[model samples]
Target: MRHLLVRLATVLAGVTVLAAPTAASVNLDVAGFGPAHHALAGHGVGYNINGYNWGGYAATGSGFTSVSATWTTPSATCNSRSDLYAPWVGLDGYGSSSVEQTGVATDCSSGRAVNEPWYEMYPAAPVYLSTSSYPVAAGNVIHASVTYAGGSSFTLTLTNQSRGWTYTTTKSLSGARRSSAEVIIESPPGRYPNFGTISFTGSTVNGSSLSSFNPVALDPSNGVYEAHTGALSGGNFSITYQHE
Candidate 1:
C-alpha cells in the first residue's frame, strides 16, 4: 500500500510517466510527490506532473516546519462501489518519503457517505478518530494541521468547528523529511466519489500564506476521474470534481 499510488510522475504528449524516486515511496498517500508541474502541452518545462490522485497545491522546498488549513467537509454523492474521498493538510511526500497528516474522510461503502476525522503518520496505517466522538458531517467547517515539533516528533491536529471538537496527537517518524507542505483533496488510494467542491481557506505553512510558497497545482488526473483546482488567493482555493 505504500508505493501503490506512485503513478504518473510526468506526462508527455504521448503519455509519459516519471516517479519521485526518494523517501516518498515509503510514505503512503493519495499521490506520490513526483517531480514538478509540467504539462504535456504548452508550458512544458520537462514532463507534465499534475493530475495524479490529488488536486490542490503543494509547496515544495525544505525545512518546512508546519502546515495547516481550514475547509468545509464536502457532501459526497456516493456510488454503490464504496468510493472514498478526503480533504486534508500535511507535510512532506512531495519530494520526500514520509507524510504526517490529518483531515476528514468520507467513505461511501454503505451506500451512503460516512464521514469521519482521521490522521496518519505515513508508513503506518491511518487512525480514524472514534466515530461516536469526533463526528464529521457534510458542510461542517474543519480545520487541520501538521507541525514538525523536532527530531522525528510531529503533532497532528483536526478540529470540527461546527461541532466544537478538536483532536490532537503527536507521533514520531524517524525518517520523515519535513521537506514540503500541502493542502489537497484526494481519493484514498482506490475508487472515488462525487464529492462536490471543497473550499479551503486560511491555508498556511509556517504561519504564512501557502500561495506565497509558490505551491505547485495538482489536477488529480488519474485517466479515469479528474478534478479541477481553482486559483489560489490569500492562501484560499477550491478543488472541484469534473468527471469520471
Candidate 2:
C-alpha cells in the first residue's frame, strides 16, 4: 500500500504559486494487495513503471536530466469506496527507489469528482498545491516538467494552460538514484481509482521529442500484477482501465 500526505484547498481567482515541500511515499508492493489488483506499470517515452500504469520514456543510463509532457485531464469513474488516480512527470523512479513528480489528481471520492494539483519527492509525502488562486479541474490541459538542478536539488513546474495558472517548486532530496525519467498515471493504495482514460502528448526527454527514440511497453512483472494496461503511439501515450 502507498501512503500519502495530502494538502489541499479550494480556490477561485488570482493565486500566487509558491515552492513548498510536502511529504508522501508509495509502497509499490503488489503482492501485499492480493491477486485481483489491476494496476499496470509501463516505461518508455521517457517513462518508468512500478505498481501503477505509466507512460513516458527513460534514458538508457544514469537517468535523464529533465522530462516534460502536456496532457489533458481524464474524467474518471469510481467505485463505492472512491478510487484515486494521478498523472505526473518526473525524474527517477525507474531503477531507483526515489522519484520526484508533480501533477494533478482526479479522484472519485464519496461519489463526487475531486481534483487537485500536487508535487512530491519520494522519501517524502505529496503536497497539494491548491490555493484560493490556482485551482485545477477535469479537462484542463496541463503541462508539467521536472528538472535536475544539480546535486540533490530539483525543480518541478506545472502549468494549467486551460486556466492560465501555474505552480513551481524547488527542493532538495537525499538518496535519489537519478536512474530514470517518467510520465505516469497511478492508483494510490486503497481501491484502484478507475482513472477513465488519460493521454500524454508532446513528451520529451533532455528537450527532444520521445518519437526520436525507441520506447518500450512496461511488462507486468514490474507491477507484480497481471495487467499491461497502456499503449504508446508516436509521441503520445494512453492509459486505460483493467478488465477482469
Candidate 3:
C-alpha cells in the first residue's frame, strides 16, 4: 500500500507539470534588461542599479499572480544617440532569470520623443503591439497589467487611458522563474536615454498594494547611471532619472 501511494503521488506531480500551459517561443532582439547602472541617492524603495530603478516586493514564494501600474508619460531626451527608457511591471527577472512584462517605451530618436506599447518574455525580444489599433503618445495616462494564467501562460494589457485606446495580448512563456513582481524604470542595454521624471500611481502585485511588502533598494554593482524612487504611499510611487 505504501509503494502504491508513493507511485500515485509521483503521477500526480507529473500530471500537474504536463497540465501547465505552454508559452509560444518568440525571437528576442532587444538587449536583456539586466543589472546596469545604480540608483540615485535617497531614492527607490528597494534595489538600485545603473540602468534600472524599481520598487516592489522581493521574496521567493509562489510568485506574483499579477502585477499592474499606472503612469503618466514622461518627456524623453536622447541627447545624441537614440536613447531608450521604459516604465514596466513584471514577474521575475529581479534575482532570477526569466521576466514577463509589458509597458510603454518612451524613446528618444533623432531628438524626437516616441512612445509605444510593448510586451516581453525574457529570453525573447520585446514585441511591440502599438499601431493604429492602439496608439500612444506623450503625456498620456498609461495603465499596464500582467496577469499569470497558471503554468507558462500570461496575459498582458496596456491602455492609453488619456486616448481611450488599449492593447491586450495573451502569450505562453517558458522558463519563467516567477521570483519577484516589480514596477521599474529601465534604460535598456545600449543607449542611456534621458527619461525625464515619471510618476507611477496605483502600483499593485497580486491584488495587494506595494506598501504591503517590505520594499528594498536595488542598485547595480557598478554605479554608472543614476535614478531615484519616491516614497511609497497609498500604493503609488515615482521614479526620476538623475543621470545617464
Question: Where is model 3 more than 4 Å wrong at Cα?
Answer: 1-61, 219-222
How much lDDT does candidate 2 score? 0.59
Q: Would you estimate the TM-scores of all the predictions?
A: 0.81, 0.72, 0.75
Q: Across residues 156-193, which tens digit of lDDT does each residue of candidate 3 receive?
A: 89888998987888888887777677787665423445
Q: What RMSD does model 1 have? A: 6.4
TM-score of model 3 (CA atoms): 0.75
Give the Cα-based TM-score of candidate 2 against the true structure. 0.72
Highest lDDT: which candidate?
1
Query: If the candidates were sorted by their lDDT against the true structure, best first, what order would they fall in?
Result: 1, 3, 2
Model 2 lDDT tens row, 1-244: 1233221111101212111122132232211111111233344333334343333344445647888899987666555343555778887765555678888876554456577788887646677675457777778899999998988889999999999998888999897766666676654433334555667898887787765655544422223432343556656877655521
Index of the highest-TM-score prediction:
1
- At residue 239, candidate 2 shows an lDDT of 61
Which 10-residue span in candidate 2 carries the lowest summed lDDT? 29-38
Using TM-score as the measure, what is the rank order of every candidate, best first?
Answer: 1, 3, 2
